[model samples]
Target: MVDNQSREMAATDPSAELVRLINGYQISQALHVAATLGVADHLKDGSQPSDTLARACSAHPASLYRLLRALAAVGVFHEAEGRRFSLTPLGTCLTGDALGSRLDYARWVGTPGMWQSWGNLLHGIRTGEGAAGFTCAVEAWTYRDQHPEERAVFDAAMTALSRAEARAVTEAYDFGHFGCTVDVGGGEGHLLKAILLACPDARGILFDQPQVAVTAEGVFASAGLTQRCQVAAGNFFQAVPGAGDAYIMKAVLHDWDEGDATEILRSCRRVMPATATLLAIERVVGPPNQDPSGKSFDLNMLVQYGALERTAQEFQVLLNSSGFDLVGVIPTYSPLSIIVGRPAPAA
Candidate 1:
């Protein structure tokens, strides 16, 4: 299917893709702003005059209208009368009493450093590097270290993403068989806490970097899970504590490439008991458009990190290299699927 004419137009038309891509950032940024401002939450009943919203939010009326208008133009929200806007279907995804409300995640994405790193999409494609090191024009991890506020956003965003899935995963899996469970690279201990709450017999440990571990204290106490949950702080690159009868890592493996991902898995393998289970719950991509979120997130991984959301077969290969065998892939209520594997028995 060589379309000579279409190819020629695409080659010659410089503005076609770039225009949308550039403006697409604006759309995302606008959604972030609107979500942060609780614009959709206010419009849950119906549209109101722009001035009223501006006064409520302590923002300028004209500027507020401009932001709403721009968001409405993108179909995130809808406008009926002049300067009056409300939630669209897409906007509603950011609202309601849903577990994974986009509010926290939306705000997190617009946070300065996270937003700035995404601008390096071109760097990921051109250089094929994480572009993580360049954030400071000097040392790597500098941006994350220097900006604890942005890191808080990142933590909240991860928690926001895992919210609905955490509950879903907890219910979908039968943890009645396990004694202790460790969540490796578990951001803020949200998912593990969800699992432990669901299966009270299961004791949980949260393993993450020191900074993120600080957040677990609050989440644990708030959930009244302080008695059941243990928080451990360290890098998974070196080792993972082998304290659990089963290990679960949701949405963590996809953030790294094969080498690094394999390393983390191997570290888990080192810690996991011979009889323990390893679960990698991730967006298992299939044929194009068969699943929207998985496919879309595949590109997100490429553009943001130097990794990928992978297929089940791909997950198997990485797990195999790390001293585990693919056991099964379990589909849950969410877009993510669980890829289960377990290590060879110890002598």
Candidate 2:
């Protein structure tokens, strides 16, 4: 779609694009500040002058005005007469209570620790491990547990992602065949709840760590699924509860490296009935030089968890080694792709 002149311009002046890329952090930080200060929420009713927002958010007026000016330049907000700022579509998404809001997500990603961890991305790449101790020895959850407020924000951000992606997954796969679908390591049971809603006749089991199971139980109860769904607590690396026509693990395996990931899968294999299916809902990395969401997320897994998003062939190999047969991948409406597997035949 590019015209020859546009192509020539890019070919001649790469500095402009490079500078834009370098300044990307400015935008991220701006959005983080907006989300933390609830700037979008403050302007929800209508446009307001920077002074009003500064007073409402308890921030310095001049500093807040400068921030808003920067954001408005980036199209996050629109500056109008009287120096009033109105939320643009992108800015509205920062409001805490907006549908599928990413406020907590912004705050969590922009946390000081997270920022420092990302700064060591070069070390992660050089050593093939997380330089900031974000890998298995000092997991991200360890940091979360130490910071309760940040943990809450992390949970909220996860819930937001689930709210956005769950329905797409529900539409992508048929749950009717399984009488009891167990969401292994499912936090708060959002995806399972969505599946149960879509397939009214199917039942669900929310399996997770004890703390997560407690929340899952409450979520199922609130969804009026108490009778149809149960909460089972266990350590996935050691064992998973032995029950279900199908087991679903979404965004779980990418948190661990191959050894740990295999161990977790083997635990499921040990408890899985021969007739059961294992559905791994994850982002499958594509070819090189392409800008796929999974590719960028792969880098995130690398620096944050020392994990890698696998190609379909890599997944096939992993599943084959973990006592499962690789069945094809089914792409969902979202970025995630479902890697279907079943128990391998007896040796």
Candidate 3:
């Protein structure tokens, strides 16, 4: 009784596919563990026995061996012999050592902290309230503000991500025209440093809160930008440093509701000279049925911050309400597009 349905079912078994899907979570956890343990650094050039690797990382041999085997199967490492594994090119990069590594970002995103908040996404959808309750009953910034250990992890991941994004923003934008610039909410000043390196004549300001300014000093000193760039520890919601020709905010406005986003913009508007321009770098959500990054990020804002990504039309409305109008939008080399607006000339 070899029916066609029976034959097809036998040829394409479902168990393996289901198992692969079910175990995808383990891949994320394993990579997180690998990054935490510095396995990629150890395995960079060659292979090592599981027992030896465990000793180096100070973990149990059997537990470490299991993780290594799991990671190896997924192409992060190569199981060459009985218990020795070598780092594949993919594996070494998972250590957050690459030019544009998302390794630490992945770790932070998949950690229990963010994972549990995302677990409450349904609540966000139903109530229109964000997942602050699930995320330590605090906003993302507030969570980092309270927990020092978590803050360090978050800061490290953010710095890495910012550095990677900086290259694209620097190369894509024309900074030559601007004599001076300021990066608002520019944690660690990497973005400002990159912009300074790109625009030789441009001196700069890195205006962020007091806690953030401490981190900026280290970055500025490292980049030798302390002489050219002024790191001002202040609140952007209160005011922005009014000296720069151009004021920039990256991935900042989308975290706020439209009203708050406008307030922030208006603050910049208030501090600016009539000729000063504003550059807000954000993901411009395209039309519906377009599967762009902003679409998913919009929902992320919905769950995480009670915010949403804006279409260009939406941005125009906000800009006009804030006493500025969208002069034009520039597409940059990064995922972020530059929304260039200016204060009213005279009217």
Candidate 4:
């Protein structure tokens, strides 16, 4: 809810505030354009004249300057004397190689396919289906495969988000006790890499599609964990190879509807030993009338995958149906919660 003080400020100029809200997409579009032009990366050397920056980014000088002017008003850049602009702290985050960079993420979500898909939000609400009718994760992946550049952008965005969440998850969970851990649908193996780094004694398995596994292998070699971890490529809906003391799937199940989620869980369950444990890491939905990131994520799931972020009880039911008992939910510094489960005892 908007606080009363904030409401009062908006109330004083309701039309202006309402119009700003209505036109919020313009800011997003500006950010997308800036990121796509590599503006932050170009400014990394130092401030430059708008004409020079335009030449570097291969844009019309006058138009580039205008975009920077708008962005600077929003604190993304610093407009100096004589049409020179420099990267602000916020603008630096758009640098491709910057730590925690969101450049690719901005570009990815702003791509025409995604932009138009989100525009079809009403269709999803009315039909309970993606406007494009994506019925499974594979369809989306296949679409990405056909667009190599967009796929690369999407992959980089996932990598950035994984890096952002990895430290919080590793710090919150004690992986030291598990002899082995398997990261199902682990993209680029970042989470598993963090786990292995934290628990030096633990060997790990990173599983995903073959194309994704190639990248994960590189990540493992770069981390000097090639010997300690193995990369296995396959669909989770079919099977997840390599048994381990623990299995973890982060932000995976939320990409699926209940039937598909259960099938994926059952695939994991078949491989789980009686003593083995499972963890589903996701942002759990909160109560009614409360705004949480999960609520926004749920809408994203609806528009993208026809899925929903689950509550604790919803997760418990999913686990129970898959032959596991939900034990506890562990809090992380991130929005993600680790829903812990173990195989049920003989009936």
lDDT of each: 0.80, 0.87, 0.82, 0.88
Winner on lDDT between 2 and 3 is 2
- Best lDDT goes to which candidate? 4
Instruction: Please provide, for model 1 over 1-347, each residue's C-alpha lDDT reduced to its tens digit, 9 standing for 90 to 100.
Output: 85999878876787876776667778878878887787877877887888988887788899989998887777988878766777788888777354467777888778766676677767867877664544445322466568877766665666677788887787778876888888898887778888888787778889999977988879999999999888999999999888688898988898889999989998899877778999888889987658766886776676556679998889888887889989999988888788989995544
The candidate maximizing TM-score is 2
Off by over 4 Å in 2: 1-12, 134-137
Q: Provide TM-scores for the models.
A: 0.83, 0.93, 0.85, 0.90
lDDT of 2 at 272: 90
Which parts of model 3 have CA positions greater than 4 angstroms off? 1-24, 286-294, 345-347
Model 4, TM vs. native: 0.90
Between the candidate structures 1 and 4, which one is better when assessed by lDDT? 4
Sort by TM-score, best first: what order?
2, 4, 3, 1
Stretches of model 4 off by over 4 angstroms after superposition: 1-15, 132-138
lDDT string for model 2 (53-104, tens) is 9999999999999999999988999999888999999888898888778888
1 versus 2: better TM-score goes to: 2
lDDT tens digits, residue span 191-241, model 4: 999999999899999999897899899999999999999999999989997
> What TM-score quantifies how close candidate 3 is to the native fold?
0.85
Predictions: Cα RMSD each: 5.5, 3.3, 4.1, 3.8
